[model samples]
Target chain A: MVKHCSVFRDKTELEQGVAKMAELRQRFKKVVLKDRTDYYNTELPSVLELGNMLDIAYSTLIGALAREESRGAHTRTDFPKRNDEKWMQHTLVTKKDDTFSLSYKDVSFTKYEPTERKY
Target chain B: MKIDLKIRRFNPTTKNGREPYYQAYSIEASEGMTVLEALMSIAAAQDPTLSFRRSCRSSICGSCAIKINGFTKLACSTQIIPEHEKAHEMVLEPIANHTVLKDLIVDFDPFWKKLDKVKPYLMPPETQPEGRTKEVHISEKDAEAIDHAQKCIMCGSCNSECNALEIEKKYLGPAALAKAWRFVGDVREEGGRKRLGRLSDDHGIWDCVRCVHCVEYCPKGVEPLTAIERLRSRAIQEGIKDNHGAKHVEAMVNSVKKVGRLDEAAMTFKTLGLLRSLGMIPFGLKMEMHGKMPHPHLFPQIKKIDEVRTIYAEIKRKNKNAKKKPKG
Candidate 1:
């Protein structure tokens, strides 16, 4: 229930962003209530609202998806294992013309050697 | 079980360009085989040149801390089989936020330097007796506090995970602050002010962004964030309000105490002390532009302010009770 205002260049862009977020929220609510699944199970929206309800471009989604294992706050019950080799790299999600792409970034091996992650 | 151990190695004397590179070695792991055991086997069988530090094989003597997989943990403590499910690969490297001395070894000088800055020793009120010093009696409650502090084995795991250290290199990370709290909370310590004063520097207590990374990473359950918060409260109570960061903390506390929630606009204004303080005016305007500015009239109220007050009061009461309880 967080709300924020963004200065849109034109009404159309603002409308597009709001509409997209509304649709995304509806899909999210549906998944939470009925499907018992997350956004990853279905098609991701072009816009994602983060923090105190500011519309973020869908660029962050690919990175989120690339992380197959659930760690920290990023929980994916379906994929509930830490896959180090495939998913160790940091996922970078970029946006270009209403589309999103996912890329992996290698973790700095200088200090921390990733070991058996146990809480 | 066979486990592939990938260890990062660096040789200082041998080559001009001895960049860090990974060396994978196969090791047989038993049911209770710790990462340290596997490492020891590798050193014994394959590579004697491999270097790392480990004193107490148990978690106590924090010398064997390193990054395993992607997290910081003591090699002596971490069991290997749980980490290796399918591929059976274990990546071992030095602790983060430090220069690697060699393979799996990091320079601990910087970490110890931060520890030294906090004056990590208790200074009691009365001097000890001549020749034979009397053991200062500590109650169960005070002993609990001391125990929490003493749990820190100086592993530097929290330091490696600290976000403040990532941004501000000079910032005194969690381990030192927790060490500072170990002294500050000690009822025997007569010079609490001196300890508080030491943490009042630029790269000291004020620089913490409250990221809670230290709290998350500390294996000892020592909440360094809580320690930092307690230190802030003590600092404020002692009337040490010179720095901008201290002033901001005070203002936030005041706002939270008065109103149930923080008045962000008021906090920003009070923190700067004036409308036209250098760089503040435009920053304030920029927030306003971004619609991030909170309206003073629209102070967000917590529904159960009394509940919060009661919780805080109960905590204070418990602390008082603990302090008053006689030593056994």
Candidate 2:
């Protein structure tokens, strides 16, 4: 998941990560805790956290796949230029009623406009 | 290479952890795999029940302090592969001098309490001049004094390995004392004398036995024993010398000053004073009976006593108005 959503990512990497994450979520249902006792029950919580991580990972992969431009850490080798015409917004992932949704909101430039980043 | 990890696990509800027993797990060793990675992998695949505390995987978090082969170390930094030995004989357990709440997790309440007693945070000045808010400008050299101390992530590694804490729980452990010195060494602080007075009380700064366990085992290289020594010297310099520790230090210095060697009898009397020295009469009689007591008058006079005084005079002249630099 990390390699797919790394510093240099593309459409194929995002799609592969999204598919692998879906498989991971399905497999995570069978995972069981060896220690079910309540005293410091990290075993149960850890499994749940892993499930949550898979969900987040899936959402991130989808968001990266949907956005077709290079921006910040989500730089793509295929789309190397920042596309302000179509992709100038914030990617927000939401979960409701057991379903995951990916959407974007327009960034408000109240103080400073988004200019070309220079070293 | 395959490595066998013997981890001491404890869970209040389980039979295997009723008395805290070791559980062995054999895992295929990979290059550059840390002990923390090995434990997490084992818990995920092999057992799914083994418990330990870890985070960051970097040394900054300081949450992975565990006993590995009788030494407290951060598991995230310690590699699973042995450097010299063929198979890394791994034994993981919780650090000592703390209440073991569960598997590899100790109760940090006592440790946090000690830190609170030391007042770790820098205090704001009592009065500020009208309308001119400015930064306390300290030189780079001045800030270098506490650079190592500032790197402490509160791992509790020093507190775990402290021998004084093993003997006397009331004694302020190394981490807290070092923290006390951090503020005391800062030139910006306004209350150095008051801080030293409080630290000089019972089970405080004077209680450290100079075991140097804190110095040797501190993972961050924060030599807390050196800080404790500095605090001791600062306490003496500020004239808070009524306690037994300061009196004993003074007695030794005075002996070294007057004669070329230590006058044991005079030093003892001065340090312990009348009432405490009277309690030592039985021990003195025993020493006398065994003919082991070296009488002060019987010792030969040294002709080179002037040389010792000259060295002392030079040191005094050099540090005529020194406050930060300790006197010997």
Query: Clash pairs of candidate 1?
Result: A113-B67, A113-B68, A114-B68, A114-B69, A114-B70, A115-B68, A115-B69, A115-B70
How far out, in Å, is residue A47 in model 1? 62
lDDT of 1 at B228: 86
Model 1, residue B114: C-alpha shift (Å): 2.0
For candidate 2, the docking band is medium
Candidate 2 lDDT tens digits, B1-328 = 7888899988777776779889888988799988899889998789877777888999989999998888888988888786215434788899999998888989999989999998987754588645646766787887887766776778999999998899999988999999998998886776788889999999888888888888888888989988888889889989999899999888878777787777888777888899988999999999999996668787564778889889999898877756456321
For candidate 1, write residues B1-328 as lDDT tens digits.
7777888877564463178888879988899899898887776557656777877898888889898887788888888898777335688888889987666778889999989989888887666545535566777877786466668889999889887888888999889998998899886777888778778778888888898877777777888888888788788767888877788987887677677778887777777777435557677688889987678788867787887777768987997897687533
Model 1 chain B weakest lDDT span, ten residues long: B125-134
**Candidate 1 Cα errors over 4 Å, as ranges:** A1-119, B86-88, B126-137, B275-278, B300-328
Q: Candidate 2, after superposition: displacement of residue B166 in Å? A: 1.0
Q: Write the per-residue lDDT of candidate 1 for residues A42-117, one digit (tens) a residue.
A: 1122122231132243333334444566655555455666677777677776657545567778888877787755
Note each model's CA RMSD in angstroms: 27.2, 3.2
For the second chain, the TM-scores of the candidates in order are 0.85, 0.90
What does DockQ come to for candidate 2?
0.71
Give the top-scoring candidate (TM-score). 2
